[model samples]
Target chain A: MSLISQEVPAFDTRVPAYLQRLERAMDALLPPAGTDPDRLHQAMRYACDGGKHLRALMVYATGETLGVAPECLDPAACAVELIHAYSLVHDDLPGMDNDDLRRGRPTVHKAFDIATAILVGDALQTLAFEALANAGAIDAEQKVRMIRSLAHASGSLGMVGGQAVDMASENLTLNIGQLESLHARKTGALILVTCQLAGIAARAPEQVRHALDRYGRCIGLAFQIQDDVLDQIADTATLGKTAGKDQVQNKSTFPSLLGLEQAQHRANALFDEARDAARSISGDAEPLLWLADHIQQRDH
Target chain B: MSLISQEVPAFDTRVPAYLQRLERAMDALLPPAGTDPDRLHQAMRYACDGGKHLRALMVYATGETLGVAPECLDPAACAVELIHAYSLVHDDLPGMDNDDLRRGRPTVHKAFDIATAILVGDALQTLAFEALANAGAIDAEQKVRMIRSLAHASGSLGMVGGQAVDMASENLTLNIGQLESLHARKTGALILVTCQLAGIAARAPEQVRHALDRYGRCIGLAFQIQDDVLDQIADTATLGKTAGKDQVQNKSTFPSLLGLEQAQHRANALFDEARDAARSISGDAEPLLWLADHIQQRDH
Candidate 1:
């Protein structure tokens, strides 16, 4: 399943450009870090600042491959990133994972008081919806659809539900199917919606949208498996988070169920499927292809 | 400012009907209590139940007055109530107010674990936007506008901002203006947006919408002042929550700064203004007038 034998393209030259654009858009959407309620606002900006911007890159890459303009995708990009950031902020609270670091910095509750951390998460979630609601260049119907998809993906049956199940599953054994379902909701739902947002923004036909969704599904699971693998092999310094904590927490991970080697093989299989789905779509999918490869090969 | 001189109409017969409709609509929107992730879903329902339904009632009353169908207003009503419920859940967290009782029942964090409470709040907040986004009978444009208003009112610059300020202001002296500003955001923003949702649903003219906004603003402040006044005068049994906690927590209140009598007078003044605004709107105005009177006269 290795892609090294095939002719590979250079890294997407557009990645840095997309990252810059997303940052600018996010800054515009966020409240000024200096304003009153200064502490909460500053924390909000801080939580958002350092990240891989992976979800946002999905939005931009998917939309651009479908020939949608980059500017039109900014709000959707910001929405997913904000949702991701807020989830981390809440997850790292004392009642949850109680992690001290994220993105190589102190967690929100560690840097600020717990109350401010809760508010920051709450406010960031609100801002995600606001960004989509106010996003220009898209029609009202599409915006509504995007908002609906994003909300559903983030709600109890999706990301939050997954988190709840994950929490409840701690110290309990889960079969492979159950673990996949949980990860599908906890991380995969948001990842899947990133592509959905882009498809909605592009006004893509049903078939193209389905293809993009398939692509998203594959990469989403692949990315998560890779994460689990990294937790086993990567150091805390490289991961920018406490590594191997999953084993310590006794949580069921892909590697735990399938063994590390089988787990990585599974991720490779998903990445290959993702590449095929990307190729099935009309227009340039080189970026999607590049993203799939990058996700599979990333060490941290 | 007293309205004792005017002859009052009987209580609005539609109030109970609106409440019934809102409850049914909310039930339909929420996941079944017995579903998987049972604990989180159950806690969400638990937090939502037993509220006074004042915000949803505001939506129903105002929309009905402006001639929007009750069915059209149901989603908006559910949305505001969801937002209010989520706020209460998070506000009761140990890191925040650490309240043990709400509406005479154990707080979500007390009945459920803090992790469940946090997820419940997060899920409910997502559900609020989902309700608005999926609202039937409204055109795409109006739905977008409602979503925008709700998100803005809920985000950093609105309810969350007010909460941050309130938390920071504990044990510190705040001037009358500062206290009012804080309460306006903490409580008033959501209340004001309730009427705005109704107006948007009704597609009311700008003039009438403006009048409803005036009525909402007046009643919102009046409502908060009455709450402060009740905290000073009422006991825990009557308030269904911990009374006198504000003073105990060293939080400033209207009666604390203005003295009890003056604070009550100020609430009455706001009530009178709300009545005038309600009268100006071209509609039955009876429901709104009744709501204003009800809010002003409620003991809890």
Candidate 2:
């Protein structure tokens, strides 16, 4: 993450605090009881926290820039994180990516049983929509929009679609174009939805929503490419998670295709293009500008 | 079922026709296309269709009894089916019930892979909200209510929560009370939502909505009890699917907790209670009467 080198951007005053608030909001809205509440809640804490949280930050930042009251996006912010957490949980399942580690501790399936992992993932996915619908003070329609966007991003034609491609890729070699197509769904969909959800949370115009979504698509993969590059360059402690697991698995990846140097160059170029894309399409916004910078500069 | 003596009483001419329309609408609203059309669509189809039409009928009946045009409830009817379909897809996952057979055919995982089955379930869950949001020509508030009920039923406190209990019961002996709690979330949450949704579709008074929801919870458990009994009584050929697998697996179901005779008696008393529950809440309506009679006697 090129952006990881930029001193963490002086810690956005509102974002980290808002992220905490949103996390609590989400936890409160979930089932009060379940299969080993202590374990599930503990795993949820690790999975949700301890990240740079570029996605949640983007949603909050854009909503701030658009003049929407910070409180107005509580539902939206919680909804996005719920989706993000759910994706991670499912991605590590036995029949899926089958990874054993995440963040630091064992992956969800490893920490809990696979059955608990699946249900926990399912509950989180559903809790996201519940968070949207039960966001305390938001009107029902806004909650509906928030939940729908979160669902669309996490469902088919989005993150899950991308995972399907990534899973299938184990069985076939892919050209650069196919690789990008696969990443578009897996990595790009949520990132783009991040932009759209932020804009929608602000009640921004449809044009604004569409433009930020476009920005999300271009930069999301660049983020992934940088991730690929960093995996080769960075260690586990540096990245805050396991690195080079993708190569070990022989999965098609950005570094595998473009070479380390080429992938890095592509990420830098895409970041610049993303900045231009936002400016050209939706005029300009400082949050998006910083977003491009954040994606390109992160170290982890 | 102990209540199997009842018949599908002849109803007014418009009733069946109204139900047919709702079935078409519900089917049309579901199976929304994903980027990968083949796998996602087939999984969607397998997950969604061939239900008993009980949910859709409830909406139409509630509307008819309340003097609302039958079409007024179509959107809500469609939404309930979507929620039901999504739950079935998730419940059939490898980590959950692990059933390879559903509705007399191979489960979605058997037809596709486990990952596709998961995606299909996730997508259908999201599509339920999407359908509520886009249901043709419905009021904003109506849309909101439909979204609320769908989310509640699909979330942790409902179907998914019920599933956790069922899964945990594999190594434990559950008494009748525990069985009821398990089915309450697994089956009753959505059934209650179904009646609530129908009452909402008719724009019934708050009291009417409350009453029908009461009816829903009653029938929901009765339906599940009869389900457990039918697995013992109905042949695989007649059930169009595997039966008696529950006992063979040592699963703690109602019939297992109490013997077959006691379970049958309990189911019959519940059926009468459900009918009384409906009557206690509503004026004479042929459709609700027919619904109670039909559910109590169904063979499949």
Candidate 3:
């Protein structure tokens, strides 16, 4: 069965437009082809070519909820997506996951040489911070805070640290608690940062920020659990990646430990929690609420 | 003849004190060795373990010349050194330069696994910007500029981009101009940023900033030429790295394009220009002047 065939919830009418805006903003932000070091630039664009843009959506959704203008949120959207793309490129490298495919296309290291892929990932990571620093909409103080937040979430104590743990635990059996911590850092940190960045952008009040944090945490875990469920039930074509990769690599996942039915239930519970968190903020949080449902119901 | 046996310049009386301060600061700034993801953090510290710290010294010297206190400059100094260390770790990976020895010891990948080394480099790069963002001395505006400057210098258009070009140019003969451009981006960009950062910290006048820039450019080129010369003359033990790896990899160096004698003479000339640039500034530029001489005279 196709994973996309699952019953998906209706998204906000503004989502398609937001996605288009994000694509355009990202294209404009990246160095154009035929630039010097054309090969590296080309590879970077390739790595970022296609994705669901869920993270970018979160940024826009949170910003809109906090009453920030869409244009003002563009840089954060682009920056988070760039960071996501770079992480995928590195994660798919031969020395890492040794994956040959990503997003239904040959991985960067597969299309280009390993060296070019490495450089592409490194350069893309650098550009993420560059984008945030150059973001003119925010004041200098906000830019500094944004940079610090992104860096803290992306560094050894966050995504990279989680990756190190993930790599180390490839063959070892991890308990449910350990797995949660792993995915929290490996995938949740970046997602959570998207919300924090929006808060920074809108100068969100303390209560709003706290509510957004809760919403982010709930949805972040829900997103990962859904991923684990999809990996188990979906085929490679449906997932657009190497399905069952976690199982094949003997990496313990949510479904692996909790069983497929329980994992799905867990995701649904998290979605409810995420919705409640968003409700705590008395404003236009419709998009964030819609994304929580989308994350739970969407196949891939 | 051993490169270290050559007549080296006498050091400044404060050089040792500065080095000690830098070492302590870097140690404190980095995560403790016992931190989680112990292996990756260990590799990061290992890569940063020991070096001449010429880059950090440049930051301190320039800031001091511009009347910025040493304590105020510590973050920039540490940040640049971390970036330098991360670059070296990545460059020494099996897929890139394939180097096994660095700083008279096994490279990060050699001591740890390839995967761990890659994570170490990625995490360390992230931490560099984090350090700059969290730097307490500078105001938010200065911090943003510093982050942007460092990111621009370290990105594809700068260090990473130059590395990509260098890898592509391997086994292909490059003229002196090509080599200069390559080294300017690869090695010189970070060095130049050290001085630029000092200017940013001090909020130096336009003229002082321009002179410091010229000084940085001259010293950057001179430093690379001296590296090329030392690579040709020094053995593995004296150079503290695989001295002839460039030749073995069929890579071109300054002495390869220009004759050894011409390379040495060119370095001396650049050193003179750098000294003059420092003298143009209206302050006690003694440290900058001494560094110029040191670049020309030092073997490694």
Clashes of each: 0, 9, 0
List, residue by residue over B44-101, the lDDT tens digit for candidate 3: 8998999989999999889878879888899999999999998998899888998999
lDDT on C-alpha atoms for all candidate structures: 0.92, 0.73, 0.89
- Tell how far residue A46 is off in model 2, in angstroms: 5.9
Q: What is the lDDT of residue B143 in candidate 1?
A: 91
In model 2, which runs have C-alpha deviations exceeding 4 angstroms? A1-11, A32-49, A277-284, B1-23, B30-37
Tens digits of per-residue lDDT, candidate 3, A183-283, equal 88999999999999999999998988899999998888989998888888899997889998888899898988999889989989989999999989854
lDDT of 2 at A176: 92
lDDT of 2 by residue, A168-285 (tens): 6784778999888888878788887777776766777777776776678788888888877888889987876688878777877777888888888888888887887678544336
Task: Give residue A57's error in model 1 in angstroms.
Answer: 0.4
* TM-score of predicted structure 2: 0.89
lDDT of model 3, residue B177: 90
Taking the tens digit of each residue's C-alpha lDDT, what string does model 2 give over B1-300?
587566644554566787688767766765454537456766777777676767777777766666666666787777677777777766777787777777778888888898877777777776677677666666767777777777778566677767766776776888888889889988888877877776776777877777687678778888899999999889987786678978776788888888889987888887777777677665566666677788888998
TM accuracy, model 1: 0.96
Query: Which whole-number lDDT from 0 to 100 does residue B291 have in model 2?
Result: 77
Report how far off residue B271 is in candidate 2 (Å).
1.9
- In candidate 1, the residue pairs with backbone N, CA or C atoms under 3 Å apart (3 or more residues apart, or in different chains) clash, namely none
